[model samples]
Target: MSDPVSEAGTIPVNDSTPILAYGPLVLDVPGRPVPLAMKVSAPATGTGLPIILLSHGHGMTTFLSSLRGYGPLADFFAAHGFVVVQPTHLDSTALGLRESDHPEAPTFWKSRPAEISFIIDHLDDIEAAVPGLAGRLDTTRVAAVGHSLGGHTVALLRGMQTRDPADGSTVRVPDERIKAAVIIATPGEADEQTNQDMLNNYPVNKYNDFSTMGMDALVVAGDKDLNPMFSDRLSYRWDAYTRAPGPKTLLMVHGAEHIFGGISGYDASETTDEDPERVSTLRALIWAYLRSQLYPDDPAWNRALAAMGDFGTVEAK
Candidate 1:
C-alpha cells in the first residue's frame, strides 16, 4: 500500500507496509513456571522512533492470545514507524492455563499488568531480537494500547485500580514508564443491575474505579457495542472515558460492535459489522493521538480530529 500522509499529516499509520516481526521470544518470569513470550514488530527501518506496547484482549480462543492477534492495529502501528510489542498473557486460551494452573484464574488481571511491566523492564532485549532494530527506538516515548480486556491492563498501569477477583481487595499497580495509553472497548464502572452476577463470576469487574486515572489517554467506544454478558445498556462501555478525569479523549464510533470491523483478524466471522474502512479510521485516529501525545507541540492530533469531525463524536479535554 502507498504511504499517504493526508489525514494524520506526519503519522502515515493507515498505510500497510513491510514489517519485521519476531516472536515467541521467551523471557522467564521470576517465579512463574510459565515463561512470558511476546512478538516484536518494527518498520524494518528508522531510528529514534516511538514505542507502543500492545496488549490483546482475552479473545474467545487461542489465536488472539498468541502472537497473531490485532492485525489491524499492530500492523498499522509498525508501518507508521512505532516498534510494537505484544505479549500473550497466561489467561489466554493459547496456553490453556487456568486459575488451577497457577494462582490467578479466569483472567490474570494482576499478572497481566506485571507482564507489561516485565516487557518494559526488558525492552532492550526485545529490541535486539529484531534485526536492524538496534538503537532505533526512543524508549522514553512509549505508549500502551490495548483492546477489550487488555484495555483494563493498560488502565491499571495508568492508575486505574480494580478489585482483586482472588481476594476482593482493591489493588492499584502503576508503572511510571507508561506515559500514555489508548484503551478501546474496555469496561467501566460495574453496572449495578446487570453486573452483580458478573462481579461474582469475575470479582475484578467490581474494581473498575476511574477516580485516579490522571494520565494521558484516549478511550474509544462504539455506539452499539453492548456487553450482553455484563451490561443491559450500550452506554456501559463509555464508563472508561465518561467516568475518568480530564486529559483524556473519547471517540465513539457511530455504529460499531465489539470487534469493530474485524480488528481481531483479517476476516474473522465475529466481525458482524465488517468494514475495513472503520479499521482504517481507528488506525488513523490512534496514530494521531499517539503522535500528538508522544511529541510535544505536534499538530497531528488537531489534524486528525478535524478530519474525523464528521465520522464520530470525539470528546477531548
Candidate 2:
C-alpha cells in the first residue's frame, strides 16, 4: 500500500529515506496494573527529529486499537522526518483485561491522557530501548495526533474539560509540552441534540467542556459523518474545532465518514467510506497541516489545500 501523498512535492519532506520501526517496548509505569506497551517509528537517518505521539482509537478490533495498529499513519510520518510513538491505552480491547469496578471502567478516559504524559516524561528510556534512536529526538518539538476516542484523549491534553463522575468535580487535563495537535472524529458535547442513549452508554460525553480547549490544533471532521447513535447534528463530530478557541484550523473532508476513509488501518473492514484516494488525500492534508504548524515558514499546507480543490474545505483562525 503506497501512499500517493508522500511523493516529492506533496509533503514537505526533503528526505526520501526508509523508516526504522521498533516496537512493543514495554515501559514499567509505577502503579499501572499493566506496563505501557508502545512502538517507535523514525526515519532511518535524521537528527533533531520532531516527535508525534500517535494515539489509537477505542475500537472493537483486537489490534486496530492496540500498539500494533495505525501502521498507515505511523509509517507515513516516520518516513517524513517525525518520530511516531503509539501507546496502547487501557481502554484498548486488545488488552483483554476488564476493571468494571473502576469509575472510568470501559473507556479509562482519565488514564489515557496520563499515559501520554507518562510517555513524554520517559522519552529518554524509550530512546535507549531502541537500537540506534538514542540522542536523535528533540523533546522541544512535539505534536499529538489522535483518532476517535484517542481524539478525546488528545482533546483533554489540549485543555478540554471533563467532569469526574465520582464527585461531579470539573477536570481539566492539559499538557503544555504539546505544541500542536490534530483531533479526528471525536465525540461532541452532550447537549440538547445529544441522544439520551448515547449519554446512557457513555456518560463521560456529558462532561466534555470544549470551552477551555485553548490550544493550537487542527480538527479533522467528515461532512457525511452523521452519527445518529450519538447525536442528530452533523457538526457534532467537529465540535472540538468549532467550540474551542482559535489559533485553530478545521479541515472538513467531503463525503467522508467516521473513519475518514479507513485511517484506522489499511483496508480496514470497519471503514464504511473505504476509498483509497480519499485516504491518500486525507494523509496529504494532515501531513501538510502538521508541517505548516510545526514549521511556520512551510508552505506545504497551502500547496495541499490547492491540490484538494474540491475534495475538502479548510478554515483557520
Candidate 3:
C-alpha cells in the first residue's frame, strides 16, 4: 500500500523503510470529529501481523513526535513484526473542552472508551483506503496502551462498569475488539479534596465485572509519582479483584514520575533526567507484555517475557 504522509509532510512513508506514517484522518464520532495521527510499521517481509492500537496520554499531539521523544518503544514493537497504530485525541483534550458547554467537562476522562471505539471504527476505513494493511491487521489480537488519563480510559475500557449518578442508568462502551489492555499511571477513585474531583465524585459501578470482557490487563505505575497515592489505589483495586478471566500484572517503576518517563520527548529536561534507567526499563517491560499477549506461540516473545523481570522492579499480585 502507498504510505500516506502526515500533515507535517516531514516523515516519509516507504514500504522498504522501517516505519510508515499515515493520517491526519478525520474520525467522526457521535457529536465530534477528531483529527488523528497514525504511524504504521512492519517487518521487511510485510506479512499479516498482530495489530496494537496505541493511544497517547493527554496533551500529546502527534504519534511520530511521541516516537521521537520516547526511546524506541514503538520501534521495538515494529522490529518484532507488529504494526503499531498511535491515534491522537487532540479534539477531545481537556484543554479543548469548553467550560460553559461542558460544565463538568473534566469528568469526560471517563469518556475515553467512547473515543477509543470511534478510533477503532475509523481504522477499518484506513485499512481499506491504504494498501498492504487491508487483511494484514489481526483485530482479534488487539490491545490498547494508554498513559495517564489515557490509562484511566484503559481501565474503563477493560469493562469496569459505571453508572450515571443522577439518573442511575448504565453506560455502555462501543468497541469490543480490545482483547487486552495496559494502563500506565492511572488514577483511582479520587479523594475528597479537589474542586473538580471527578474520581471522587464519579460513579464507578464495580471492578469485579471485567471477566466478561475477557481481556488480559497490565497496570504499571511509578513509585515516586507526585500522585503516587492515586496510582497505588488503582493498582490495588486491580490486584484485589478476583473476577477478571485473563491474567493481570501490576508493576511499579522505581524513581519514575507521573508523566511516565517524561512524555516521549524532552528527555534532557531536569524532570526526565531523574530516572533514565527506569524509563528504559518501562519500555522494555511494555515490549515484553505485547509479545506474550499478542504473539503467544512465538518462542522469541516467550524468551523476552521471561527475561523481563530481570530488567526492572516487578511485582505481580
Candidate 4:
C-alpha cells in the first residue's frame, strides 16, 4: 500500500519538505488503497495545530495534474501550523476511469466519501508514524478546502446529498469529522435534474443539517470565472440561500479568475497568479475562520476576519 511515487519511509521534519506520503490505508473500493500527499512542516511554538484536507478540482487528468496547477497553498498552511492532507481524487477528475484502477469505475462519486474516510481513519496511525506531526494534529478542528468541482465534493463531505438515480437512494458522506469548509468557485447552478435530486435528498431548508456538521464556512469566487453567471451572481445567491448560523462568509475577488488563490499548477495564463494582496486577504480570512471556530477566545482571529475585506477591496454582494 506504499505510494508508488515516494520513497517508503517516514519523512523527517524540515522547513523545505515538499511532499510526504501516507498509505496502506485501504479505501472502500476494492484493491484501491488511498494515497495522501502532503507538505509537513514544524508547527509554531505554543500554538495548537489543526488539520486541513485540501481537495483538488476536476480536470482531464489526475488530481496530481490539478495539484501541479495549484501553488504552495498546502505548504503555506503547513508552515502556518496546520497538517494539510491533499487526497488524489483521480477518479473524479475529467480523465475519470482512465486515471483510476478502481473496480467500480463508473460510481466513483458514490465512493469519494470513502476516500476521505480512509484518510480520517488513518490520522492516528499517521501521527504515530510521522514524528513531526505527533500531538500537532487537532483532529477536531479539521476543515475541507476545495476548488471548482472539488468544492462540490467538500459540500458533499459535509453531508450534502447527491442522489443516485439508478438505485433511487442517496449517497451520504461517511466522514462527519470535518469541522468547517472553504469552497472556492463552486458550481452555483447544477442541471435541473441534479438540482431537483439534491433538493429531494438534502433540501436547502435543511441547510442547517450540513452547517451543523461544520464549525464555519467561507465560499469564495472570482468575478471573471469561466462561468460568469455562477461564479458571480449565482454564487452570491446560493450563499444567501444557505447562510447557516455558524459564521458563514462569502467573498468575490475582483478581477481574479476561477483558479485564483489556488496552488500554482492550474493558472495557464498566469492571469490567476496569487496577488500578494489577495493571498494575504485569503490567508487572513481562512486563518480567522479556523481560529474563530477552533480557538474562539483569540482576539487575533476576529481581528483577522474583520480585516479580511480590506486587503482586496471589492463590491461583492
Candidate 5:
C-alpha cells in the first residue's frame, strides 16, 4: 500500500485499482427467521488480503441500511486491497420486518454481532460464492466497521456489555476473531441528558457498558452529531472512545454530522453533510487505521495524521 501524501492529507483513494464485487450470497442459518444475505467486494488481484466486515446502520432509507448500501465504502476499501463483506441485518427496512415480529426486532442488537461472527465463520463459503476470491483472503486478519446502530454491533464484538432486561443477566458478546474495529457515530452511556422517551423505547441502550471494550479500536465521532432523540449532549457519540479502556483512538471530525458526509452510500438522501471531500478524507483515515491495526509496521496511520490538516483531530490512548 502506498503512503498518503503529507501535502494533501489524503491516501490513494482514486479508483485506480479494479475490483470484483458479488452480492446477495445467501446463507441460511438454522434458527434464523430469514436467510442471511451479504455482498463481497475485493480487489481484482491481491493475495493474503485482509478482511473487513462492514455492518450497516439503521437509516431512514429503505435500502441504505441493508447490504445494498455503503457502496462508497465497500468500493473504496475493495479497490484499496481489502476484502469487504457486508451483511444485511434483520433490522433493515428492506426486509419489511417489524419490532413486533421478534423480541429484538428494532435493532436486533444481539443478532447483529452474531451476524458478523457468522460471516467470519463462513468465510470459506463466502470465498466459494464469489469468483476469484478463493485463496485470496487472510482470514486471521479480520476487522469490523459499523455505523450508527451498526457501530453498536462492532462495540459488542469488541467486548462492550449491556444487560438483558428480560432475564437480568449481563449480555457480553465478544468475538475474539475480530482483531480490530472502527465504531462510528454510535450512542453513548445514557444519562440525565438522555431522552427518556428514547430510552423507554429501546431500554437496552440504558445498559451500554463500554468499560470492557479493551480491544484495539478507532472511534470516529462528529462534533456536530447531536441527536435530541438520544441525548442533548454533543459528546453523546464519543462514549465508545472516552468510556472504553486504552489502546483506542478517537477521530473527532469537526462540524461533521451523523452520516459523516454520505458514508452509507453515494448520493444518499439521508446524508445531511454531503461533502464528497469529507467522505474521501474519512475513508482514507479509516483505511489508514485498519491498515495500521493489521500491519503494525505500516506508516499509513502516521502519514494520515501528519496530513490530517483541517480534516479532523486524532488522539490515541
Candidate 6:
C-alpha cells in the first residue's frame, strides 16, 4: 500500500512544489524511558514559513492518536507553506498503557500542551532534523491546531482552564507562545450549559473554562455531529466559540460528525459525514485562516470571511 499520508496530495500549487517530511523523531528528555516522538513536514522550498503544532485526539486505536493520523490536514498545510509538527502523547493505545486512574483521566489532555510547548522550545533541533529546512521556519508565527480531545489541548495553549476535582481549585496550563489556534470539534465549558451526559463522560469537562482564551482562534463545529458518547446537545460543541474570549471565529459544518470527514485517517470508517467537498472546503478555510493570520497581506483571509457561508455559517467576535 502507498503511504497514506503521502498519497493524500497537498494543496494546489501551480509551480508543482513538493512537501518535505521527516518522521519518528524521537525527542528524548532525561530519565524518560521512551522520549516524545513526532513527524515534521514542510514545503520543499520556503523561507520564514509559519509553524503549526498539531495535537492528535484520542481514539480507540493507536494510529489515530499517534503520529499516523490527520494526513489530510498535515499534507495540505505543509504543501501550502507551513511547518507542521505532530507528537504522539503517552495516552496512545499503541503504548499499551492506561491512565493512572489515580484521580482523573486527562492522561493525554495534561501532557498534550506540554508537547506543543516542547516542540516550540526545540524548534532549532526540529529544523536541523529536516534536511534543508533549517532557517526556513518563522517561529514568531506559530499556531496550535487539534481535533476532538486534541482540540481541547489546543484550547489550553490559547489559555482555556480546568478545575482540579480534588480540591475544586482551578488548574491552568496556558502557553502564551502559541499565537493562533484552530479547534475542531472541541468540547465546551460544562457548568450550567452542560448536559448530564457530557458531565459524566469526563468530570474535567464540567470544570472547563474558556474566559482566558482571548487569542485569535477558529472554532469548527459540525451541525449534526451529535456525539452520543460525549454529549446529548449538538450545541455543546459551540461552547468554545461562545465562551472563549475573542477575537474568535466559528465554522459549523452543515452535517459533519466528530471525525470531520475522515480527517483523523485517510479512509477511516468513523467518518459518518464523509463528503469530500465539505472536507475540501474545511481544508481550504483553515489554510486561508492560517495564511491570513500569519501574513497580514494575504487576501485569502478576507475572501474566507466573505465566502464562509458556502460551506457553513461563520460567527466571529
Per-residue alpha-carbon lDDT of candidate 2 for residues 1-317, written as tens digits (9 for 90 to 100):
97554342333344557999898899988877789999999999989999999999988888999888887778878888899999998888888754456667688888899999999999989988998999999988889999989999999999999998768888898999998899999999888889998788778899898989988889999999998988999999999988998878999989999988778888899989987677766776777788888888989888777767678788988
Off by more than 4 A, model 2: 1-15
Best to worst by lDDT, what's the order? 5, 2, 1, 6, 3, 4
Error of 2 at 297 (Å): 2.0
Over 31-63, each residue of candidate 4 has an lDDT whose tens digit, in order, gives 454444433333444235688777766544444
In terms of TM-score, which candidate is stronger, 3 or 6? 6
Tens digit of per-residue lDDT, candidate 1, span 54-151: 98888775687667888777888898888999888887887877546566777888888999998899888877777788899898988999888888
- Poorly placed runs, candidate 4 (over 4 Å): 1-47, 61-69, 92-107, 191-215, 226-247, 261-276, 309-317
Better of 2 and 4 by lDDT: 2
Tens digits of per-residue lDDT for model 3 on 124-217?
Answer: 7767755556776666677787776566567667765546554656654525687667877655443343224333444342222344434457
How does each model score on lDDT?
Answer: 0.81, 0.86, 0.53, 0.53, 0.88, 0.77
The true-versus-predicted C-alpha distance at residue 103 of model 2, in Å, is 2.6
What lDDT is obtained when candidate 3 is compared to the true structure? Answer: 0.53
lDDT of 5 by residue, 123-193 (tens): 99898789888898899999999999999999999999998766778998899999879999998989999
Who is ahead in lDDT, 2 or 3? Answer: 2
| Ten-residue region with minimum lDDT total, candidate 6 | 5-14
For model 1, how many clashes?
2
Ranking by TM-score: 5, 2, 1, 6, 3, 4
Clashes of each: 2, 0, 5, 10, 0, 0
- Model 4's alpha-carbon lDDT is 0.53
Candidate number with greatest TM-score: 5
